[model samples]
Target: MSGEQAGWALELYQRSVLKQQKFAGIQSLLGDTAGKRCLDIGADNGVVSLLLRRGGGDWSSADLAPEAVASIRSLVGGRVERIDGGPTPFADREFDLVVVVDFLEHIPDDRGFAAELGRILKPGGRLIVNVPREPRWSLVWPLRHAIGLTDQWHGHLRPGYREDSLAALLKPWFEVTAARTYCKTFSELLDTALNFGYVIKKRGQGEGGSTAKGTVVTQADWQKGGAGAMKALYPAMRAWTALDGLLPFFKGYRLIVQATRGSD
Candidate 1:
């Protein structure tokens, strides 16, 4: 890939197949955001925040990682903040919507943070969340462990979430209005293999203080040559990723949920 193409690859990293699935899932529930006040939390690759912003919402983003804060700001370019993992800096009932992605499972005080989510949203505000769903019975478990993508390495405080358990975590002030799973068997298989390759390439590299937020949270972790290699193979990867759509019978490996804030 040319240097320009490599830079394009870096920008497009969040456009991965799995992430596109999550974005489609979110947009299905999100509908119109033209006049809404939205906040996206978690240090996801900033792609989620970018996708939502395209809906024309007044958007802001926050993360505990300085790297993510800088990265996300470069994309969304408005009101990205670096937080310290305490109470957030926004005002009470300050937002009409909040989106959480690949993040809740990492918090040591998740319930407390759920309260914080509730505290910042207006009555009847919307919440959209995406999380890993790695139940013990999941067929993907063996490969996941084989690739060194275990919860410990990913900085997960817990393995992941089930629909019920995740609902419980958001129970304090949100009512789950919709729930579903994505990243089914074929997709999981493809994603795991891709992750293994990245892990193999990125092996032994210092985590740049990202271990606490998950080691591979962004494609930036793929770095120079890794990004170029990924850009080269990206077309085949996208084609491989498309196989998942043909088989709906397989159980998925991640969950996307839509919820609404409850009245005080």
Candidate 2:
């Protein structure tokens, strides 16, 4: 790719990483966002807010970066808001749907972020979240470091929330209704690779944690995907996508949960 084309490609990739199949799943599962007050917090590019708007939700967005907010305005014709500091400047229980998307990982106090989710959501409101799962390819750290790409491995990963640990943290403020794992399942040895996942809503006072442990990919599994191996593994690739909704550990990613506010 030429210089301009390469820049364009990188832009597309960033957008893809931000708003891809995961958001699509959220949209499909949540149904028409019509008539719902939607807030896309930490909405870097406001893609999700745009999506919420396209889905007929009353959409507004907030981002910490002025450039990001400006970018959102450029794309969707203005009306995007800039969040002051790290605080969410919204009245309590103002929105019906609050999307945190990839924001949680970046926030140091993830619990405070979760509490903000609870605070902003109306009673029985829903939060749509997407976060990176544990990186199974830890063995590649050396190579990635050599290439200047491993400055901070899982730089945003919070302590005590792989799969099971996450459940404990959020359950106190929300009740998990629809919970399942979504991962990229392919390759030869490991059926799935858990890069990232999502969470949905079910109502609850948000307490209780699960003792469940999830499978993690090993270095041996990464070694199995040698040159020319990914193409050879294509046929089975479709199978993992088919099986993602059912089998959590076997997929490349971890869990996607749906939780709602508690009735109490």
C-alpha local distance difference test of each model: 0.76, 0.51
Write model 2 residue lDDT over 1-264, tens digit each, in one string: 134423332333233322355665566557657888987765554445555666787777876546556655655565577763355777788888776554566555777767777877888888766555555454433443453232133334442135555666677888766654444532211321322110000013142211111111112222334213444544455554455446445533444566787654
Tens digits of lDDT, candidate 1, 58-89: 98999766667766776667699876556999
Native-to-model Cα distance after best TM-score fit, residue 63 in candidate 1, in Å = 1.4
RMSD after CA superposition, every candidate: 3.4, 12.5
The number of clashing residue pairs in each candidate reads 0, 29
> After superposition, which runs of candidate 1 have C-alpha atoms over 4 Å from their true positions?
1-15, 204-210, 216-223
Clashing pairs in 1: none
Model 2 misplacement above 4 A:
1-19, 84-86, 135-146, 151-161, 183-249
lDDT of 1 at 132: 87
